[model samples]
Target: MPRWGMVIDLEKCTGCQACTAACQMENCRLPGEMWQDVLFYSEGEYPSGKLTWLPRPCMHCENPSCVAVCPTGAAYKAENGAVLIDWERCIGCKYCMIACPYGVRFYAEEKQKTQPDIRDVFPAKGDKVWDPPYKMPEQVQDPKHGVGVQPKNVVSKCTFCYHRTSKAPTGLKDLDPNDPATRKFTPACVVTCAPGARYFGDLDNPESNVRKLIAEKRGTRLLDQTGNRPQVYYLAGEAPVIPETRSVRKPKQSPET
Candidate 1:
């Protein structure tokens, strides 16, 4: 039983939205519905200010507050340590939304539908776009689970692409070690990262890359003060030094004299 986890190196992250896009496309999320996001925080003076880019995802806490507050038991910590939602049981009460400190939980406003009047198109071969038949309302599918339907009203967030990871071919489950096609079990965002800043694996395995990263990089979890024990860890980045500023003195009024 592996406790799946993720490590995000803040030093290597460039604030690119590739991971965000990849997750959305893989998960078939609707427009404006994002499971992961890179939040930017800045402080200090303009010339020499510090900028921090924090990529936030479902923390999958060991003691998830969302699970505690969910009256319908929609949110719960899976055996693998991943926080999961049972859409069928979710009553859209949004109690989990208020309990979540990371702000990862999202309530689907309305079921997504493809308008028949609008011409649909997709990339064909080398062509950028090809006209296709009008598509009707389609539910987001989990490619691995073959479950492509999301209930009308439920809270949703990143599943670490569980459907993809679990169904991966026998030898392809581990991304760090593999041979060609057999090495493609990485989560959608991890696969799409240009800088390879994100690492995923069983945190419990001492030999796993994620565990090694935590030991070597001294990764820290966000909001440790809350005692949520989030599975996601972050490698601290160099803090930008802000130069001290002095008040400028007005020039002597020689012309007035």
Candidate 2:
């Protein structure tokens, strides 16, 4: 059984958000409904401050809390270690959303019906090849598998590109440094990374790059204390840490003299 996983090299990642863009286009997620996010913040104070951008995706934990809390079994881990959501079974109770420690889950909102924009309106060409308006492959539209064309009022998250990965031969090990078909099976975010900071493969395979990188780079998991045992590993001097939740406060205005 292949246990898929990812290794993110923080040092090499510039956080340009290419991965986020690729995921959106591949999954057809709406604006602001990013399956992956690049979080940026400053470290230190004053002139010595430094900026860091961290890429975040689903952890696909070995002991996923989302799966544990799901009321209708919408959240489940696949045979290859992908944490998937069966949109058909999802009841929009938000239990898995609350249980996810990584904050990767999202509840899809109902899109308002609207007419095409003036600029987008075009005359009917009568089935022209390479038309301006083309239908992109909708991954979330599969109701049975819940892989593409995400429906409204359902919780959705990353699936490690299950549609692609599930096609890989059982004997296959490394996703990268392998056959073209195997490479095509990896998540879009993994291959789209320009800096090669993201790696995906079977973590259980000794020869896999994911395992090799984690071992050689001293990779670590986030919030391991939570006992979720996330499969995603970070290889860097320090893994990105999510700050404790705090109430937002408005900036104080200067008093008039």
Candidate 3:
């Protein structure tokens, strides 16, 4: 099987949150809990300040800290290199949340982050934790891999759209959104990215677009110090390089002060 992975061309990203929205809708997540986020921050002080953005999804690390910390074996790495959570096995210990350095994992239960608790408003129907007005493809609803609307008390993160990718023909290298042949099978975030900043493919294939971009552009992963060895790579290009998390820059001090 192909070692599935993703490469993001940061130079092309516009931080429009199309990827974020697409992930929410495709995965049927609650409003406050999105699998993707585009963080914005500034560098330098006023006159010289520059605004930059970084879009973060689950890294799907080869040595996932989340997987390592899950006591119940609820979180496990799939053969294709995806870190997936079996909602049925997950006990909502929140160990994965604390283990993740990227702040990507989310556990939403009785405590609602969004006011009025959408869960209580919509209420769950049958096995589903909450019924979303928008219906997702029935095929994508697999709790075993943490797809579809999450069950109560389970930690959830991105699965690289495994439901689609797993069905792709054997030995396939890349799933490019621009490619008509692979467009339907591409990850929702990758497909909805208006600027075409994202690319998903087999990392093991040297001929794949994702691998080629990583090689030519010297792609980098976030939080390298953690030694998780992320499968996701960022081709920063002309965009600001994200070496570490960006803390919001404070304003410059006046001479009078």
Clash total of candidate 2? 6
Q: Which digits, one per residue and each the tens of the lDDT, describe model 1 over residues 1-257?
A: 67778898877888898889887677656555678888765555546655656777788898889999989777777766778887767777889899887888876554435533221333222221222232212343442221233454567778877764554554322454223553366677888888888887788878788888889978788878777889998887564321122113322432222
How many collisions between residues are there in candidate 3?
Answer: 0
lDDT of 3 at 42: 57
The lDDT values for all models are 0.67, 0.75, 0.85
lDDT of 2 by residue, 1-257 (tens): 89999998888898899999988877756556778988765555546655666688999999999999998998888889989998778888999989998889987554424445311353323321112233245443454455665555788898887877787778777777335777778788987889888888888899887888888888888778889999999886665443322212312331211
Instruction: Score candidate 1 by TM-score against the native.
Output: 0.75
User: lDDT score, residue 16, model 3?
Assistant: 97
Report the CA-based lDDT of candidate 1 relative to the real structure. 0.67
Model 3 quality (TM-score): 0.92
The positional error of residue 136 in candidate 3, measured at the CA in angstroms, is 1.7
Question: What lDDT score goes with residue 173 in model 1?
Answer: 20
Of 1 and 2, which scores higher on lDDT? Answer: 2
Cα-based lDDT at residue 242, candidate 2: 39
